[model samples]
Target chain A: MSVDAATVRRIAHLARIAVADHEIEHLRGEINNMLAFVEQLNEVNVDGVEPTASVEDMKLKMRDDVVSDGNYAKRVLANAPATDDGFFQVPKVVE
Target chain B: MNAPVRNPKLLKGDKHDWQVVIGMEIHAQVTSNAKLFSGASTEFGGEPNSHVSLVDAAMPGMLPVINKKCVEQAVKTGLGLKAKINKKSVFDRKNYFYPDLPQGYQISQFKHPVVGEGIVTVDMQDGSSFEVGIERLHLEQDAGKSLHDQHPSMSYVDLNRSGVALMEIVSKPDLRSAEEAKAYVTKLRTILRYLGTCDGDMEKGNLRADVNVSVRKPGDPLGTRCEIKNVNSIRFIGQAIEVEARRQIDILEDGGKIDQETRLFDAAKGETRSMRSKEEAHDYRYFPDPDLLPLEFDDAFIAKLKADLPELPDEKKARFVKDFGLSPYDAGVLIAERETAAFFEEVASGRDPKAAANFMINEFFGRLNKEDKTIEQSPISAEQARHDRRSDRRWHDLRQDRQRPLRNRLGRGWRPARGGREAWHEAGDRHRRHRKGRRRYHREEPGQG
Candidate 1:
């Protein structure tokens, strides 16, 4: 699908990325180019191929359900921009 | 003679016979030792952020590995619901920005959920049963808690809940009344608790529901639905549905259109208020996460999980009816919770099930209710109950006569509860006051010490 300026703005907002007004045109062009390059695969005649979610044909690696890590509250909250009485602080969010 | 089945109460309007339809999206926190993709402790009460892992905190280089027990729990829950366990399920990035959610997007199942097409049967108080169709059950990550009361201009985020596993079970719009909706959640919670998948503690925020309520004419096409989000209490869920149905009926009767939007239930006000307009809502850009692989398991895995499944609420209820010869309503009440069912089974083994039901239901439960005590907190022991059942003459005659008072006094030194009801109430008042003073520390939030 072709990308438009308004669509690019929406996409940027959804992704939580700030895009400048002048940068929308450039981003849209780049996105449309990528889509077009991927669309070229439509010309291939292999219709019976199964749709694959990933390139790797493998099972998911799993970890045992055990509490092996944690109890590092200070380290966990070390990078927070703000911290309160033992909690990471942020600007008040309205629902 | 068994009384005729009573229809569930319906809302009567001015002229139109309005019908209420409800659907529920329940978020049940999976019971696991660690978080969904992190090694963070899923323990409820800990120092804030004390249970956080690098992955839970959303560090740059952190990656999520699938927790095998979580997937197995989800599958077991699906089987308990009589739902299909999809062999191949994929996780998607549900993109959104919120302060509590450290990651910009949450890993959830969108199109290909792990469980599909299940059925949940709800038994009503009036000796009636109805089946609610399960659309799907998907595994997702939970967001942290935002404590708004800690500061004025700032909200504190606790990463303890971050990266925890949740099973979002969605139901079809098959419920007809608020009572049915409440019953559905209760039954669903019981099944989940039985499966050991979720603790099903609503007060702890382990289980919360998003109820979709709509109103329509008796035979007219379905009406637009308004979703009330994040209702944590069963009583409030029933109230929300009833209040929302009335609100919609008023709008439709006044010749106005009901907008499809999300609303919040204000328990204190006993009403639902608009939280967001449908037009301004976020369009969550869901896409398959590239980091995670597709979750695929064979039939043998499902069969093994199935083989290990405990007897669910329905199975136990049926057994109670067939073996104990208790009424359907009595059987439902006895088997509502696994602990209560087990307690009853142990006390009633080799004894008259109907007599046991009577003693347990009328005498034990009545005393517990009067004492304002839960089954877990009951002072009476099962051995005491068995002893009372055998030696007490009142128990042998309680079957043929309904008016006979239970002569067996609970505990060692306690007096008979039949004639001392008033005295007990007075003592109960004193005990309640004493307990109230001690309850201050226990009243804190589940995760807060």
Candidate 2:
């Protein structure tokens, strides 16, 4: 599938990234390149092979259900650019 | 079993006969100590951002690791519902933009869920039961809370709930009425509670549902469904379905079309309002996450989990009916919760099952309701019931011994009351005597008590 300027703009909007009109063509070409690379893999004949999501071929490691971490409100909120009363404040979102 | 005939209550409308079809998507928080992919605590009501971790906050270079217990809990719940457990399941990134969601995309299961089709049997209040088909149970990460009340121009984000594990159990559009929808959710919550997978506390937002409602003429093809999102209570689920169905019926009857969209139920107003139009909806570009491996387990693992499962509600109810000869309704009430079922077993064991049922339902439960307490909060103990049972056995023996002499003095039909005060006093005295004899016997026999 080829990516057009409109599709690139839509994707950028969906991703919440501000892309200028002049940069849409560049973004479209970059996305098309990635899509073309992904599409090439579809051309290979592998009817009998199982689809692989990870290369490790191993089970996902699981941790015990124990609460040994957390309770660091100060440290957790430290990375936020904006904060209020131990919370990460953001621009108002109304629904 | 075929789908239950559409509930007449849902079918009968003001102007014409209309049928309401409901499908539920219940989101139950998995009972886990930590978040789905992060080590942050999953405890509720934490101070804002207190329970968050680097992964929960969506910090750069953070990766998600699967919580094995949460997966096991999902599989256990699936088995309890008699659902097929997929040996392999994939996780996908559901791309969306929300301030509460720290990550631009939510890690969810789409196309390939951990659980496959299942069936939940819900018992109605009228001593009837119907099976609701489960579409699938997918694992997803919960977003954080956006506190809109704290500021005039900004919303405070609490990442404490972010990355928490949620089992999005989707049910087929098999429910016919608001009652059935409520019953279906009630049964599903009970099963989840029985499996210890979720607490099923809708008040705490641990369990919530997205109810899909539509109206149609009887025997007509299914109508367009408008989803009421995040209805948090069972009563509200029923009310929302009814209100939305009425709204649709009114629209159709007035020569208007019901738009397919997501709406929110106003509990205060007892109506549903449009939340988002279809034209402005998110695409949610779902794709397999490259960071995490597909979850796969063998038959041995499934078997082990199945073996470890406590006797589920349906099985316990069936045994109550078959072994204890309890009615299906009584059995259902008894087995609605694991604690209640265990308490029933303790009280009903080696006693008159029907009498035990009456005591539990009428006296025990009645007192509990009057006092506004749950079984977990009940002042009465199961050990007291055991003591009562022992006394009951002794009373039965004493009655048998006195039967001949009493028959000789009075008429043969004359007998003691089932739970008369006299019998209770006799049982108490007998218990005291028996205890004294046991103490004497222990004194006589060294080292035995």
Candidate 3:
């Protein structure tokens, strides 16, 4: 699969990245190259192979239902750009 | 009452009859002590951000670990719905941007869900039932709350609810009317509560529904459907469907086509307004999450969960009718809540089943409702009723005396009949004294006192 200019713009928008109009073609070419490099796997013939999410053949790890963490609101919001009353504050978002 | 019929005449348009179709997607918060992927407390009404963890806050280098109880809850809910539990399901990242979602994307299921198709049989108020097909059930994370009114030019975000587990149960477009939609949600909530997966509390925002509504002429093809989002109450769900259907019909009759988009229901105005147009539809751009592996379980795991399942509402209702000889209406009232059913069973054991049902339904529940108390908050206990059978008589007397308020009667303390017990005790003493006298005359055993 190859990425076109429009696809690049859409991706940038979805990722919340501010991409300039002049750089769309360059990003498209860069993305297409990446996709082509990863497309080498298409050469292999493994029709019956199962699709797996992880490289390791292991199931997801699950932890017991216990409340072992929390109550450190100060540290959680310490690095926020803005905070008020222990809440992360942002510009008013209506809707 | 007559059985409910799916009458197409119910939705009559200006020129022709129309049929309103509805489907629901219910988001139920998983009842867990901790967050789904973090060890943060999932307690409701906590101080803002007190339950936030590094993972929930999306801090750099922080990872999420799956909570076993949330997954188990999803599987239990699936079994309750009689749905197929997928042995392997993948978590996908649905990319979106909102202030409440610090991750800039939601970890959800798209291509592969935890549960597949199932059917839910909803009994209508008119003594009829219909089956609504379950499209799928998926597990996802809930977003934080964005309080817009906190400030004049800014919003505050509470991450207490972030990373909490939610089950998104989707249904097929099988509902025929607003009543059917309401009944469907009611039944779904009851089932979820019975499974102990979700509390199904709409007022607390534990359960919310997105209703899809479309209208088409009879025997015509399906029309473009619009979704009414985040309807929090069952009454509002019914009203939303009716309002959206009327809106669609009016547009179609005026030679204007329906625009498929998302709309928000205004409960105060009793109408629905478009939230977003189809041209600006969301492009979620879903992809598998690299942080977590595929969730896979074996047949043995499913069997264990299935075996440990409690008798659901439907089964308990059936048993109440068949074994206790209760009318369908009476049985329904009894099994509406799990606690109420348990209380009824305790009161009915080793007693006349029908009479116990009548007493509990007519007298017990009636009095509880009058006092605005739930079954758990009942003043009378099942053990008290079992030992003191006169409570039934007291209830009858209370019912006869309509002037006496329930609070007054209860405050007076519906005590057991001490007079009868004292009388029996006195009679027993007199008989024993007589026997002792006879014994003294026959065998001279007066010293045996």
Candidate 2 residue lDDT tens string, A5-91: 888888888888999999988888889999999899889999999887656757777777777667888887786889988898899
Residue runs of model 3 more than 4 Å from their true location after superposition:
A1-4, A35-44, B1-9, B277-281, B386-449
Can you write out model 3's per-residue Cα lDDT over B145-248, one digit (the tens) per residue? 99999899999999999999999999998888898888888889889989999998887899999999998887787899999999898878888999999999
Docking class of 1: medium
Model 2 interface DockQ: 0.64
Query: iRMS for model 3?
Result: 1.3
> Which of the numbered candidates is closest to the native, going by highest TM-score?
1
Share of native C-alpha contacts between chains A and B (below 8 angstroms) recovered by candidate 1: 0.88
Report the lDDT of model 2 for residue B107.
Answer: 98
Interface RMSD of 1: 1.5
Model 3 over residues A4-80: C-alpha lDDT tens digits?
78889888877879999999999998999889888987888889998767677777899999998899999989988
Task: List the pairs of residues colliding in candidate 1.
Answer: none
Worst 10-residue stretch by lDDT in candidate 1 chain B? B440-449
| lDDT for each residue of candidate 1 in A1-95, tens digit (9 for 90 to 100) | 79889999988877778999999999999999999988897778778986676677777889999999888888888877889778988888666
| lDDT per model vs. reference | 0.82, 0.80, 0.82
How do the residues B220-260 of candidate 2 rate in per-residue lDDT, one tens digit apiece? 88999999999888878888998899899989999899889
